[model samples]
Target: MSADDSVLLHTEGRAGYLTLNRPRALNALDHTMVRRIDEALTAWEHDPAVATVVLRGAGARGLCAGGDIRAIHRDASAGGGASSRAFWRDEYRLNDRIARYPKPYVALMDGIVMGGGVGLSAHAGVRIVTERSRIAMPETGIGFVPDVGGTFLLARAPGELGTHLALTGAAVGAADALLLGLADHFVPAARLSDLADGLAGAGVPETVARHAATAPGGELAAHREWIDSCYAADTVEEITERLADSGEQAAKEAAETLYTRSPTSLKVTLAALRRARALGSLEHALDQEYRIACAMLTSPDLVEGIRAQIIDKDRDPRWTPDRLAAVTAAEVARHFAPPAGPDLGLGAGGAAARDA
Candidate 1:
């Protein structure tokens, strides 16, 4: 499909609606989609007719799976580093724009929301989820650190739960998302269409309250304390050792999951989370992430990870440092280093414009 066909835009009454249209691809974003979204949001920002914005995916499967990474893999194969960088830059700007948007933004995060999906919904003013929603970052599986303001949001999750989630690329259902502060409202899947039809100038809260159901208890509750203790360590080595020593089934499971991911992705992700916690704002975190993303474009394991997991379907990536211990402190440090280009030009006035 053409780039313009990827996003279907519409307006009804006072609400502006966006339907991610590539159901076959799970609406995986490309540079064009990001640019189109930025353009639309910018125009709608000043239009008094648009009092609220509603965003959702078209298919039953997901809001979005992620960036068009297979496309990026193609670019990597052709040595199109500059093209990959451009895509990330535009995507990051779109993310920043959403975070700073003026109108009341509502996201129907009703299905598989990971990577780019999280970037789209996590910053919305009114984030909605349903029983079908399965949210995660899951970038480490592709041999990359989370980006598109993921580092910023994940850092603020309660205790070390964020750390555990990021490293493991584990998918969590809607209730778990609410517990992580990744979602705001829990409306059932059946009522989503009704909610959109009923939205008028300023009635979203009341309408949502009427539809909101009591979400099922989060699975994280069972292992929160264990995750907090084990993932809170200063280093990945320490965290794995602690988990190994604990003998708790959950802790052992977490360590095993960590081992399955690319070691470079894990170590760099840990450093990203650490630095993100100390950063000033989402823009700051995105800048840090932009650097890491640029690094990912150059990593051999990224190509291999996608080859095994997505291309070949073997599910076995030969990461450069195949073992965790081989990923040095300096190697971890390099991913956080400043990029050769300018920082993500997200500007200084966004956070004030949009409420966190």
Candidate 2:
């Protein structure tokens, strides 16, 4: 479909609606989709008739699976990575805009929301999830660090829960998403239409209250004891070691999952999450993510990871440094370095931005 069709936009009573319209591709966002959404937001921001903004996906599968990784793979494989970097530049800026949007921005985060999907919904003013919702920032699995303000959001999650989710790239259910602060309310999938309709005439809080229900119990709380103890380590290597020796089956499984991801990504993701904790603002975290994203475009693991997970479907990525120990501090540190070109500049005057 054309870019305009990819993101269907319209107005309903007091609400302006953005429906991500690529169900067949699970509404994977492209640069055009990002720009279109941004433009719609710009127009609606000053429209007095647009009291609220609602975002949802057209397909049953999810709001958005992520950015067009197939395109990213093609760009990175072609070696220049210019197109991919440009896409991230706009995409990340859109994420920052969503976080600070003036209107009551309500995101219907139903079904599978991962990577860029999380960036789109998690930063909104009001995030809604459902029983079908499966939310995550599964970037490491694709040899990427979580961008789109993921590090900022995940870093603020209680204790080491974010750490566990980041490294393992695990998808969490509605309750877990709520616990992680990724979502604000739970509305059953069947009632999502009712909620959307109600949004047209009523205030967001009232509409959501009428539709929202208690989320199904999540697994993370039960595992928090083991998760906090194990993931609190200083490094991915240490975290894995702790998980391995924790004697809990879940911890053991988490450690095994970490081993499957790219070693360099695992280390860099850890560093990014740690640094995000101190960055203090979404803009600063986004800036850091942009730098890491550009650097990753040149990494062999990014290409290999996309090939294994998306293209070849072999599920076997041959990372440049096969083992976690083989990834050096200097290599991990390089990801945090200032970009050779202009920085994202979202946090231009902030102390974090100055330091970065």
Candidate 3:
């Protein structure tokens, strides 16, 4: 692999590892990177010499913070294009492949793993967390809906913890990731090299079994009781109401966070999660998410939300609905509606459809 490679692909003995190289941007996924990652995985999947696949980020601060939001912002600002559509279609396909790969795929999830980062790693067979792992979906904060199969994972989270995390862009540390079943193993950052060595020497299954022994409890472990109780509500409104009513400091803080996010995003996210819960597979979940994502780009909140947050660097986002309750059922329903055209020319209407 060369320095120009978006993902540094290499093989040591029977192990093939893909290192996300964009540390400056926290390994954020751009269109090129997404395509390369999928290509590497496809190659390694059939290689007789490769026994396992390892995914990691080059920088110490973040495995990947999210997608290249600057690109999305550019697209939304420039009024959409064939290129932008192609980006989402291909990116979603890569996410799907990771979720369904046959080989044992281990993600070294350290530092910030959010948005696009989650899409790449969360679906792996072995998600290994370090104490440095700080994870979230966080798309709501930027005016984008959480795609990358996040809807499926969020819907599957124990209770309303998913909804709370999504709406608030709440960060969860290593212990919490494991407790939430987001991580399969936990190892100290210092042990990452050793884990890689173990995987290469002993093969993936055995390595995973050993690593699982060292897995630790995460942030969600502490709040399980309260999270389960408060997050039981079916709707985001009800969930917010429960959080507001709770006397606990944690619950109150969560409520405040959710209240601060874009109202339109929170509403669409809740609906996406619920719809995902009823779906059959990760691809199905991403497909549902794509519909909402495409719709969001055309909606008022997205570009303005990005302008207020990332482009302007102002923390305040002026949401259209103002409050979650202000968003009507019809307004929310629009996000899930199909795009006007013949499937956007995405082929097959199969698992890959979500990707394109």
Candidate 4:
């Protein structure tokens, strides 16, 4: 429990507690954090003393915001994409391990869970969210296609709700997360500590039952039909056209939001989602996303988007192929093709059988 530990590891009863320690940074995952987590989880996986694992962020504001996007920005700008690739390779493996964990894995998703944060928790055996929980996959806004098995989760969402969320990068609360099957239980923020205490004794399922209650409610389900309809198109161009023409205000708003994101990301993500739907396992989706991630590292839109929205704080990104019509099928295909480097290492089983 050292204050300086980026990830604090401790054992209480049968529960292994992992605390993400960079509260000031919103517990953003870095390569060190990812490696530390991998080490801890690998060690704990076979320890008979630990029956389940509970993960949370140290700060009250949230679990984790995402991977340190600033780091990605820096690495992408440096060229070669060597650093970015290494990060994703290990991070994606952690995501897969969590999903197929041998023991119960509980994720307390409190607030601001997005991007890589979603990667760490979405596949947990039991995902518990509080009223303060805000979850999303916002890669499109930064000119990056969603990775860390995002395609698998989003592709599995009811209807095409995943498409809307992916394209818009909209943050949804606990109720919506539960509705979308992204989370398992809804606990109030105030009761989270009690919930954790119980987990140290009775384990996640029983502990969650003790504190779980009806979620306040959310609007995502109401818009499912709207989302599934507009996003049903095979391409980003068609989806936007349909959304723009729809009479519903939600559709119009969605259209506006999509317009603000990277056209390259929107198109590539759409293709990824479609491919994910046809895949047999989560590993397959990660392999597909690895290709996309490598492509994004060199894409003009990714650099410009990160500069405008993050580094420069300008909010406005002059995206190359700014319009859907300008994005060619060949260009999108190149994103899905394997980059000239070591593969993502998912192997025949993809990420599912990745070594610890």
Model 1 lDDT tens row, 291-321: 8988787888888888888899899888898
Q: Which residue window of length 10 is worst by lDDT in model 4?
A: 347-356
Provide the lDDT at 175 for model 1: 88
Please give, for residues 76-152, the per-residue lDDT of candidate 3 as tens digits. 77857445566777777777778778888999998899988998899998898887789998888877778888878
TM-score of 3: 0.92
Error of 1 at 6 (Å): 0.7
Error of 3 at 35 (Å): 0.7
Q: What lDDT does each candidate get?
A: 0.86, 0.93, 0.80, 0.88
Q: Candidate 4 lDDT, tens digit per residue, 1-356? A: 34349999999999999999998989989999999998889899989999989999998778998988888888888856788898998998889889989999999999889888999999999999988999998989989987889889988889988888888889999988987889999999999999987888896667888899999989988888778898998778889889999889989999999989988899899989998999878888888888898888879888888899889998999999888889999999999888889677574654345863
Model 2: C-alpha RMSD to truth? 2.3
- Candidate 1 vs 3: which has more lDDT: 1
Q: In candidate 2, which residue pairs clash?
A: none
State candidate 1's TM-score. Answer: 0.95
Q: Which model, 1 or 4, shows the larger TM-score?
A: 4
- How many pairs collide in each candidate, listed in order? 0, 0, 10, 1
Best by TM-score: 2
Question: For model 3, what is the alpha-carbon lDDT of residue 234?
Answer: 73
In model 2, state the lDDT of residue 299. 85
